[model samples]
Target: MTEAVQIRPEQFPLTRECPFSPPKEYRDLREEAPIARVNLLDGKWAWALTRHEDVRTMLSDPRFSADRSNPDFPQMVMGRVQDDDAEKSLISMDAPEHGPARRAVLGEFTVRRMEALRPRIQEIVDERIDAMLAGPRPVDLVRELSLPVPSLVICELLGVPYSDHEFFQAHTATMVSRQSSVPDRRAAFQAVQTYLGDLILLKEKDPSEDDLLGRQIIKGREEGTYRHRALVAMAFLLLLAGHETTANMISLSTVALLENPDQLALVKADPARTLPAVEELLRYFTIVDTVTARVATEDVPLGGVTIRAGEGVLGLGFAANRDPEAFADPDDLDIERGARHHVAFGFGPHQCLGQNLARMELQIVIDTLFRRIPDLALAEPVGKLAFKDEAAIYGMYSLPVTW
Candidate 1:
């Protein structure tokens, strides 16, 4: 039997040192050896699950656990910066713990809830559009729309004051950025924790009748199943995950659409085309490259390779979404790919709880942007557009555009 190829941990730090997109070497490795050992930041090794089927199987397998409390678990970017207890939110929980915590906020992200927010999202979209049009000929969409829309929506949902957005947004960017220093990353995590801690207290004293934070506080307290730290952590996860990923998706999708005028025109000609187009774009972009880190609970053979107990597994979502085996002509942007299955929002027990809300925001933004500014075009060269290179969430710093 051929010995398994080992990828040294020092070679791949989660920082800007790693390529934003999977490099040619990764593609080659995926094909040659689906399960390869790769070095992580701290000189520790991790099993990189590269193939589409292998990633899907690993994500769904009970042996792969998301719990970060395990002492042997490799420290991913955020885990390295924050305390273990603090990282115990939904993304880090396994099975039974992950389920109820996720369930606590699932209803608020349902299609029904998102559908009700459609008109409000539309209004937000129009307001942003109007502001953009009223600006100089060219404006940065990342600044004007992509970032603000979701931030504002999530703010309202969590009942967080918009005044505090700058502080949180800065922290959010630092926490997600690959180039951020260890001190900056730790500070960012603490900033978010402090902000959420205060918000929880505020909610307890004067609850908003219907917001998600308020609702969670009520449910948590009523069930007598809540801890102060847990409530803060959960709220932090919701606010950050709720907007940050969707914001990146919106920016990335807009960039993709603008790059493909034919598809953009197709969606522009008929607003109804936005939904399907968004799905295809989500699959094509697959902006969230990796899911939360998972650890091997026991010895598990994945894709003919044996993973020993207590190894870390990183699910390369970007690779899986673009796998030719799963997606036909995966490189081509087909706006109308019927019933596409992409792991953009992740999969299984840990799938994104706010997916419906994300889709609703994307749909409304896309439909309204094209309708309001039919002549929108990229203000800068596509290649010149600066992207957040080192972040777990792939996004642009500024998406300049003009109508």
Candidate 2:
């Protein structure tokens, strides 16, 4: 057999020369070796799928398991292995278990349910903007606007007390941060888990039908389906994902819109275009790039390569979003692109559970922010901004802005 070409693995995350664009090397990977092997932070090798179709296919295939507890599963970041007894959130499970777990609380995030939340989401956006307007010049939008809006919304939805927002938000930040040591991440995980576990017990004892967790608790009891551990696991996943992803997107999207004047003008001119604009923003700024890594349970044909059983695959969603085959001028921030098909939310059955709610929240926040502050602009040069370069989830750490 002809010796397979040997290409030294480029480090995972392939550092970005520009914050708004993927690393320039991705273009080469897509054209030359779409299924190239890459070295992760831990100096481990895994197949990194860069093409859109390949990523979607891998995500949809049942053979590629999402169970992180699998020792062979790829670890993109250098950290401790996941706890075996840890709550098996939907993001970390495969079929059969994943489907039922997802369906239980799926009703809470449907398009209809999210649509019902539009008015409240708008109110939350407006209220935050009100505070921003009242504050002094050159406010940090991340603190005043981006962080609180979605945090408050998810808190209200899950019936977690909004007053305790700071508690969970701090722990979540540690959990997602790349700079956090393994012990720090573990501590953060346990802290939130303990908090949610206690909250679930409370909800079970005294259920509130209106809240998402309360409803789940009541339903679990009525159906005798979910045990205490399952309910706690569900709450942990929702609370962490609920706020962090959307909050980062809010901060990052604001920066994207401000930087692209022409594109920003389009959304400002037509209010109806905001929905598509939100989708395009999600595509362009795929913040959660590291979320989708899976281990193959069986030998799988993927990206013209046979991923043997027990091998790991990292579906680079950020890279896929920028694939030329999937998008024309993929790097451009075209608010009109309507790139809803992008895998920014991951593809297949394990796609983001709260995407519908995320869409509504982003639409309302983006539209209302610009409408209320028509002159909104970055307070400093974009080059001077401090991005979350050390974080697994990409976003600006602090977006300073003025109107």
Candidate 3:
């Protein structure tokens, strides 16, 4: 039986009253109205799925389409940083197309492959920390460590020159930020797309099988599946997503552990717990919450509500991860929770492809930073610090630390 929903739609992209946790409204809605309606920034309405079970079920069901180009698909933010306007890649592709595209690239991120990159990742973390140590007492970890680690990794993986990171990262900032005008977003998207398109041509003239995009170009043409436009869009997705999401997680995870000293002590005392703690951090701070909004292809019954065909549903992953039914003491940040089942990476067909790599990067960064700088402490209170509150992604602008 479908439960009754509320008549008044809550505003989408709800603000966090506290930086450490999700909005309190989510907790109430999870219990009372798991499928509550939300008014988006574009003034469009979509049902926000708060319950963990419902979110997982909806994401997996074929009846709900993941295609961003679908006219009825929910646009949670009015002008999103990244564009899904081009040919379908893994992100916006559904079913048959999604399967092939995912398979083509999945090998690059396999556990064995990621494990091979462990030494390199550790080196990156150590170098960043070394620089931080040698420099002034107080440094912005966002610049010193958080952003650079993932940004450099993605650049290397995609064959992009790390020298041009400033240009792309600046544009990425404008793109993800909701404060940017639609025209600003379009320009930013074009800048990235144009840069990637040119890179695609360069790879065609002189390609290397070492990097991800180049490998795809070489392999796809041989298989007769190569499309220039599709490949360019794929690069854009990989380049932006590869860096942005993980960078935010790195910063947020550090702050989380610092705030909860007991959890930090547990992790520092035992080396084996780092990976599980990273999983719990992923669950605790599900940053890209509503970006997975989907439109129903057919009338579907969910959480005691009939979502009619053409209607949209916002998968509130942040809320679902904190659902009490799926997690014990949902609000508490328990690093020992062993929350491997959490939907921080989303679930089923659309789970994050780079998850294994992300896990490895976070583990190396967190473990090394603490071990090297045993006296590491925040230079400023979290309240006084600037946060990316207006951005599509949830993270801080800077983390000032002194050791």
After superposition, the stretches of candidate 1 with alpha carbons farther than 4 Å from their true spots are: 1-3, 8-21
Give me the overall lDDT of model 2: 0.85
After TM-score superposition, the amount by which residue 101's alpha carbon in candidate 3 deviates from its true location, in angstroms, is: 1.1
Model 2, stretches more than 4 Å misplaced? Answer: 1-10
Worst-scoring 10-residue span by lDDT in model 2: 1-10
Worst 10 residues of 1 by lDDT: 13-22
lDDT per residue for candidate 3 within 1-403, as digits (tens), equals 4354443423457777688788888887787778877666676778889999999999999899998888788886675445555566568888877898889888998999999889988999999998999999789999989999999999999899999999999998889887789899889988988999998899988779989888988899899998888888778888888889999999999888899999999999997999999999999989888867899999998878899999999899999999888999977889899899999999989989899999999999989999999778989988888888778888888999997
> Could you tell me which residue pairs clash in candidate 2?
none
The Cα RMSD in angstroms, rounded to one decimal, for candidate 1 relative to the true structure is: 2.2
**CA RMSD, predictions in order:** 2.2, 1.8, 1.7
Clashes of each: 5, 0, 3
TM per prediction: 0.94, 0.96, 0.96
User: What residue pairs clash in candidate 3, if any at all?
Assistant: 2-304, 3-304, 81-175
Better structure of 1 and 3 per lDDT? 3
Task: Give the Å shift of residue 334 in candidate 2.
Answer: 1.2
